[model samples]
Target: MFSYSILLIAALCGAATSDPSTSTDLLWPLPNGNTVGSDMYSLDSKTFMFVPAGKGGSSDVLKEALERYMKLIFLPSPVPALASSITAPMDKLTVTVDSSDETLALNTDNSYMLDTSMSMLSAKTVYGALKGLETFSQLVSTNSMGQFQVPSFKANDVPSFLYRGFMIDTSRHFLEMKTIMDHLDAMAYSKFNVLHWHIVDDQSFPYTSIAFPAMSVKGAYDQNHIYSQDDIAQVIKYAKYRGIRVVVEFDTPGHTQSWGKGIPNLLTPCYANDKPTGTYGPINPTLDSTWTFLHTFFTEIARVFPDSYIHLGGDEVSFLCWESNPDIQKWMKMMNYTNYAQLEQYYETKLLELVKTIGKQYVVWQEIFDNKLEVLPDTVIHVWKGGDNWPKEVYNITKAGLKTLLSSCWYLNYISYGEDWPKYYQCDPLAFNGTAEQQALVVGGEACIWAEYVDSTNFLPRTWPRAGAIAERLWSKTDFSDLHSATTRLHNHRCRLIVRGIPAQPPSGPSFCPHEWEE
Candidate 1:
C-alpha cells in the first residue's frame, strides 16, 4: 500500500526499519504504468504501499534511488521480473530506453553521474541507473507463485574496480552492427564499463581506413564486412552515453596478414622460401617506411577515438622471420642488439614512443613485459594466459610500476562443458600472493569472448550468465558468494535474459524448459 503519487514523490527516500516479529503479506501488484517506483513500507507504522514512477529514466539511478529509499522503509529485497506483467496503473511505468547511445544520467542527492563514451549499453547492461529500472519493475511486483519470497536485506554496491572491460574481436569474423549493439546492451546490463574494439588483425582488416582504402578492399571478407568511419563513430557515440569507454586496437607486426595484403612490402618473407608469408610469422619491423605508415595510421585513430588507451598488439611475433632476414640481421648487429627479443623490444618501444608523441596511452599483451624493455609511462598490460603462469606475469608487471588488466580468468571462448559460470565467478582479480603495492597496481579485469568459436547465433547464451559472474566480480567485493548459489541464481537469470531479447537457454539442458526452445 503505497499511493502512486506518494511513491513517485518520495523517489529519493531510503529503506524502512521494521520489527522482525510480525510477517506482512506482500502480493504481486497489478502492473499499471510504464514507470514503476519501489514499494514504501514504513517501519514505525508497518504499512506497505506501491508507487508507479514514470518509465524511461536511467535504470541504474532509479534503482539506486529506490534502494536507498527502501533501506529507510522495511520491505522484502526487490527482484526484477524477466518480463513485466503489471497492468493498468502501471502502464505508464514502462520506460523506453535507447540501447545505442552512450550518455547515461542519474541523480543521487541531485548529483549527476553521467557517462560519455562511444557505445552506450541498455538497461540490461546496467551501464547506469537505466538498468536500475529493472529493479524498480520488480520492487513493486510480488512473486506470482509463493516459491520465491522477497527477503529483507541491505546491500551497498559500487564498482569494486574501475576498468571493467569486454573486448569484441572483429578481425576473424565480421559481426553485424546490430550484433555489436546487442552485446553493448548485454555488457552494460552486466555493469561492464569498457569496450575494447579489436578492429584489425592479420586474418582480416574490417575497418574502413581513409588513408589506406586498399587495406579494406584487399583484407575485408567483403564490402559489407567493413565498418565505415560513420558506423564506428555511431558505435562510439552510443557507448559514451552509457558510460562505457571504447579502446581501439590495431594488432601490428604478427597479426598483420591483412595489413600486408594492403601494403605488400611491409611484410617479412618466409625464412627459407623468401616468398610471401601471407598473414603468418614476424613482420618487417626494421623498415623505416613501416614507421611512417604506422605514424599516419595511429595519428588518424587518435583523432577518431577519444579514449586514452590505444592497443598496439605485440603478441605472437615469430623470431625466425626477424632473425633470418639479412637486412634485419645486419641492422640488429649495427644497432648493437643481441637477439630477436631485443629487436621486438626496439619495435615495440618505437611504436609506443610514437603513440606517446600523439599524447595517448598504450596497452599491449604480456609479451611487451616479457621483452624486458623500459616501461612506458602509464602503460596498461593485459594478461591473457591461463593460471599461475599468467597471474605471476601480472604481479611482476604491476610490481614494476605499470597498471594491469586481467583477461586470464575471463576468456569466454573456452566455452562451458556443463557450465563454466562457477569457475568464472570464483576468479579473484586480487587473488595472487603479492605485496600491497603489487595488488594496488592490479586495476581490473575483463571477460573476453574470442570469435573463433562464436558467432551471433549462439554467442549470447554461451556468454551470458557466465559473463554475469565476471560482472559481479568486477562490480562487487572479492569475497562475494559461493558457486552453488551463483549457479542457482544463474538458472533463474535465464528468465531475465529472455525478457531482454537474449536467446539464453535454460540451464537444465535444452529440453528441461520450454523457454529454451525460443529461437
Candidate 2:
C-alpha cells in the first residue's frame, strides 16, 4: 500500500489531468489498436440501425443488447425536450459474427475488431460480438457541442487471460435475484466470462436442492430467502444471454454447518473428555453416508448448472474439530493417519473424485495447496490467502503442475476509506516472480466480493469500479502500467455505469459526470 501523502499527491495530479484529446480511443480495457485521427461517427435515433453482416438470421441476444446500448447511450435520462431535433448522416451499425449459437459454453475466442472506418464490428462468435458491442458502447462519448459521437478508430481486442471472472459470495448474505442479475450486467459490460457463485457456506445454504430440498428449507435465512430451481435457472439464462458462464460453488466439509442442520448426523459430532459434546465438526469424512449424500447432492448441482466446472470449497477445515471426534480419531488411528491434514487430504481426494464422477471439473481454495494435498492436474487451485508470502503460494501451486487463479490481490470486501482500487489494479496475476513455464499455468484471477460486509444496497457500489480495476487488469496487457491514464478512463467508466442505472461509485476521490451535472 502506498503512503497517504503519495496517494494525495496522485489524486491531486489526476484531478488536474485532461483527457487524451489527441487520442480518439478511450477504451477501458485498452485494446490493441492504431488510432487514425479525431474524426467522429455521429448517430441519432433515426440514423442508427443494427444490421447483420451476412446471410444468417439476426441474433435475439445481440439485437436486444444493441437496443439496450442504444437507449442507454443515445437517449439521455429525463429526455431533453429538444432531443427530437437532433440529426446525423443515416449510419448503419453492422455486427458480423461467425456463429450465433448461444450454448453458454466457455468461449476463449472473444477477439473482436471494431472498424470505425467501415462502421462495422466483427467477431468469430456471438460471445465476442457481445464483448465488441460493450467496447463500442464505451467508445460513445459527448463532443464539444454536447452531441453524442463515437470517435473514429479501428481496435482489435482480446483478453489477456481466458478465465476472466468475478466471484460473489451469496452465502453470508442472500443477494436477491435482481442484485445477482445486476452484477451480471456489470460483469458483461466489463467483458468477464465467468461468474463464480459461492452459493453455500456456514452461514446459510440458499440453493434449493431438488434431490434434497431440506438443505435450503432448513438452512436458508428464511423461507423467502432461498433460490428455487427456477430462480437458479433464470439467473443462469440471464447470464447466458450476456455471454457469461455461471459456476456454482457448494463449499464442503468446512463450510457445511448449514448442510448439517438440513440433514441429521451428516456432520461429525465433536467430543470432550471421551464423551459426545453438543457440537459438531465438518461433514464426516469417514462415514459412507457422507459420500452418498454428497454424490446425490452434487449430482443434482451438476444437472442444474451447465458449466463443466464446479467449485468444491476445501478451505479452512479445522483439524481441532476432527481431533475432538472419537470416531474420526479412531478411524484416523486405524488408517495410520498421523495428522488432521492427512484426514483433510482423504476428504478432498474423495470429493474431487465425486465431482469428476458427476462429469465436472473441481476448483478448490489455496488451502488445498498449502496443506500439500495431492490434487489432480485438472483440479484448479484458487489462491485466496497468501499469508506474508503472496507470490510463494501461487508459485508453489503453479510449479506443482496444477492450474491456479489468483484472488489474494483482489479481495473487494477488504475496503479502506479512499483511493484503494489502484492496489487491485496493479496486482497482476502473473506478477509473481516465476519462470515462463510456471506462469503459464496461471489462467486468471477473480475480484471476490465476500458477502460478510455487503448486501444488495452496498454490493453494487462496493463491487463496481473496484472490480472494474481487476477486470481491466485481467483483460488488458500485463505491462499496461499507467495509473494516471487508468484513473481517467475508470472515472469515465464509473459514470457510464451510473448512466446505465448501475449505481457504481467513482473509482477515486471527488468526481462529476457531465451528463448528470448538466441534467
Candidate 3:
C-alpha cells in the first residue's frame, strides 16, 4: 500500500537518510524534562492502545484524540539523512491514559509523560493526554527511509501556570466560526487552556442570547453575522475534546453601546443644558430597571457560560457622560454621592454581589480597585494598562493581597513593519518586583487580539506564532528571554503550526515552512 511519494523517498540516492526540517532536539516551550535518543520509530507502522482505567477513564476520548492525530503527525517527506539503511517499523505503541473523566477546567491536571522507548504515553486525564499527543505529533518527521518516523525520546512535561489564556474580541469585527475553531486548534496545540471570548462591545453584539433572543437581531452587525445559541454550544463542544475552557466575556457598563440597542434606556442619555443630546455613554447606574435587567441578564449569563469565573468588565467608563446627565447628577446629589467615582462603585458593588449570589467568581479590569471600590477578596484583577508602568501595577495589585493577571505586554493587535513578536515574546508575566507571597498571588496572564482591524481574512497569520510566544512564556519555566536557541525553536514551531494547518506567518526575517504561506 506504499504510495508513489513513499517509493520515491525509498529510491532516493542509495543508503541516504533525510535530514529533519529542523533540529528535532529543539521543542517548543522547552519541556520541563526530556531526552532524545539516536533511535527512531516508524510512524507509518503506528498503532494505538488504551489501558482502560475503570474509574474515570473515557476510552472514547482517548481513541478519538489518537485518531485525530493519525493525520496530523503524517509529516511531509524531507531530503536524505546520514546515508544509512532504512529503519524497520516498530509494532503497536500502547498509549495508556488514566483518569480521562476529568473535564477541562482552570485546575485540571495537565501533566503527562511520553516515552517512545516503551512506546507509551502516560497521562492522568484526557487534558493531559491531549497535551502529550501535541508533543508526539511535533516529534514526527521524514527521512530517506520509506516511512515517517519519530526519534526515541522521553519527556515529562508540566505547565508552569494554570491559566494559559488567549482572547479574541469578536465584537470589534465578526470572525467566522471556522476561524475561531482554527485558532482553538492551534491553542490546543500550544497548550493554551482558556478562551477569553470578548463577545460583545460598542460596535456589535454578535452572540445570540437565549434569554434575550432579540439582542443579536437588534445589535449584531446583521442577522447573518451573529453566533447563534447552537453555534456557541458547538464551539464549547469542540473546545472540550481538545481540553480548552471557554470563558465568554460580556463586557459591560462602558463597552455596551450594542446592549442598549436591543434594550433602549439601558444607557444614560447625554444632555446639554438638561436637554436630550441624542447620545449615550455608560449604562445608567441609577435606574432600578438597569439593575433589574442586569440581574435577569447575568442570571442567564451564569447559566449559559458554565465557567467558574466571568469577566465583569469595569474598564474605560467615561465620567463625561454622567457629568452631562442632570438626572444622574440629581440621583447622585440625593444619595450624597459627591462624585462619579462613588456612582461607579455603587454600580459595580451591585453587579459583583449579584454575580457572587449566582455562584460564580469574577475577574475585573484593574480600574475597579484603582477607583477604590471595596471589592471581595476573591476577585482576580486583570492588569492590562500602564504600558511600561505595568510592573508597578502588578506589584501594587499583588501587594494589596489580590490575585492578578497581566495582559499589558501581550496585546497582539499592535503591530510594526517587522518582527514585533520579540517584544511580546520577551515580556515576562512575572517580570515585576514582588515578594514570594506577593509573586505567588500571580496566577497567569493572557495574550489578547482586540480585532479592531482583524477579521477572518488576516486573523490566523497575525495571531498564530505571535500568540505562541505568549503561550511559551505562560507554560515554560523560564522566559527564554536571551533568545539564543529559542529563536531557532520558535522558527521551527512556526513551521510546525503551518504544517499542522494553522497557517502561521513566519517568525522572523527569511524563513520557510516547507512552502510559502499561500493566500
RMSD of each: 10.3, 5.3, 5.0
lDDT of 2 at 389: 65
How many clashes does each candidate structure show, in the order listed? 78, 0, 5
Q: List TM-score per model, in order.
A: 0.74, 0.91, 0.92
lDDT of 2 by residue, 409-490 (tens): 7888998788999988888888787899989889888888888978887999888878888998988897887887788767
Q: For residue 156, give model 3's deviation from the true position in Å.
A: 1.6
Q: What is the C-alpha lDDT of each candidate?
A: 0.60, 0.78, 0.79
Instruction: Kindly state the number of residue pairs that clash in model 2.
Output: 0
After the best TM-score superposition of candidate 3, give how far the Cα of residue 214 lies from its true spot, in angstroms.
Answer: 2.4
Residue-level lDDT tens digits of model 3 in 468-512: 888888887874465645665676677777666788986676644
Winner on lDDT between 1 and 3 is 3
- Which residue window of length 10 is worst by lDDT in model 2? 1-10
Report the lDDT tens digits of candidate 1 across residue range 421-470.
76777788888778989888887888888887676766777777567778
- Assess candidate 1 and give its lDDT: 0.60
